[model samples]
Each structure stands twice: as C-alpha cells, then as structure tokens.
Target: MGARRMAKGIGEFLMELVGEAVAEVILGLLACALLLSLGLIAYLSWSFSPRLTVAGAGGLSLFLAYGAWGAFRNPSKDRRRRGVAAVATGGFTLAAATAVFLFFYGSDCGCL
Candidate 1:
C-alpha cells in the first residue's frame, strides 16, 4: 500500500511538471514565430512601397501597444509568463494582419 501511494504521488508530480513544460514550450515557439514573421515583414516592406511599409509598421505598433496593456493589467501572478504570452500573441496577430493585407492588396513589386 505504501509503495502504491508513493507511485501515485510521483505520477502526479511528473504530470504537473509535464504540464508546465508544455506551456513553456508552446510560449517559446510562439516567441520564435513572432520574431521570424516580424523580420520577414520588415524585409519585404523595406523594398516594396511606402504604403505597405507604413501599414505594416502601424499594425505591428498597435499589437505591441495591446500586449503592453495586457501585461500590465494582470501583474499578480506569473508575470513573466504573461508578458511573454502577450508579446507572442501580439506578434502573431500582427503577422496575420500583414499577411491578409498583402494577400488582398497584392504588391506591385512582384517580390511578394
């Protein structure tokens, strides 16, 4: 009976650890994707046109602002994780918005 109890406790601990690890891994992937998309958008906009450059920058700035707000709004628990998630969410939104804009507004430079 004691061994069974120990085994159960260990299993619960391992499950909790796995959950946290999974969350961190997901957040990390989001950060990476955000950075990569931002870089790509900047590069494409640099040579495309002033209109696109302005639009992309504006959209990204808005996302950043929203992320900052979210991070500050909930400062009691998991502050670091919340901040990371906010930034990742903002970046993903910006990237998606930029993609949609590019898709419908099709650049004339043929670089897209």
Candidate 2:
C-alpha cells in the first residue's frame, strides 16, 4: 500500500512538471505573438540575437528557483525529490545563461 501511494505521488509530480513546461511554452508563444502583432519582433526579423534568449532563460531559472524554494518548504517526503530536481534544473539553466552572457559580452560584438 505504501509503495502504491509513493508511485502515485511520483506520477502526480511528473504530470505537474509537464504541465508547468507546457504552460511556460504557451506563455512564451503568447508573448511572441503579442510582440509580433505590436511590430516589435519584426524590427529585427532579419537578425539573430541571443540577448533576448538569455533573458528568457534567466527569467525561467528565477521562476524555477522560486518553485524550488516552495517545494522545499513543503512538509512532504515526495516534495523533497521535486525540490532537488528544481534546484538542479534552475542552477543548470542559470549557469548556461551566465556562460552565454559572458561569452557574448567578452566578444564585444552584440549579436552575430
């Protein structure tokens, strides 16, 4: 019975994570659409820039970090796993974004 409960909890956690990812994607799409409609995104359609991308990633990491803090505050064993995963993911994303920022910044060439 305990094993079954654990499995169900794990499944729920997975689903919740998936839902969060999907929501983020949808939110990004909406933001992009809004920008395009407002003619902001079109101004640089012919160019490629990672500044916006790094900002997005950094923002996502911050969100995940906040979620991790919430998960850690939960008084449940199952949530500990989720908290660890969130911390790892958030740290990884932040590190990657920082690396990209440093590289581009040192290059002294804003966008390719």
Candidate number of the best lDDT = 1
Once fitted onto the true fold, the runs of candidate 2 whose alpha carbons sit more than 4 angstroms away are 40-112
Deviation (Å) of 66 in candidate 2: 36
Q: lDDT of all predictions, in order shown?
A: 0.67, 0.60
What is candidate 1's local distance difference test score?
0.67
Q: Best candidate, TM-score-wise?
A: 1
**How would you encode candidate 1's per-residue C-alpha lDDT over 36-74 as one tens digit per residue?**
676787778787897878987797677766665664565
In candidate 1, what residue range of length 10 has the lowest lDDT sum?
103-112
lDDT (Cα, tens digit) per residue for candidate 2, span 33-95: 543453455345324566775676578677767655554465675544466566665666665
- Residue 96 error for model 2, in Å? 31
Q: Show pairs that collide, candidate 1.
A: none
TM-score of each: 0.46, 0.36
Instruction: Give the per-residue Cα lDDT of candidate 1 at 64.
Output: 69
Q: Give the root-mean-square deviation of each candidate in angstroms.
A: 13.4, 16.6
**lDDT of model number 2:** 0.60
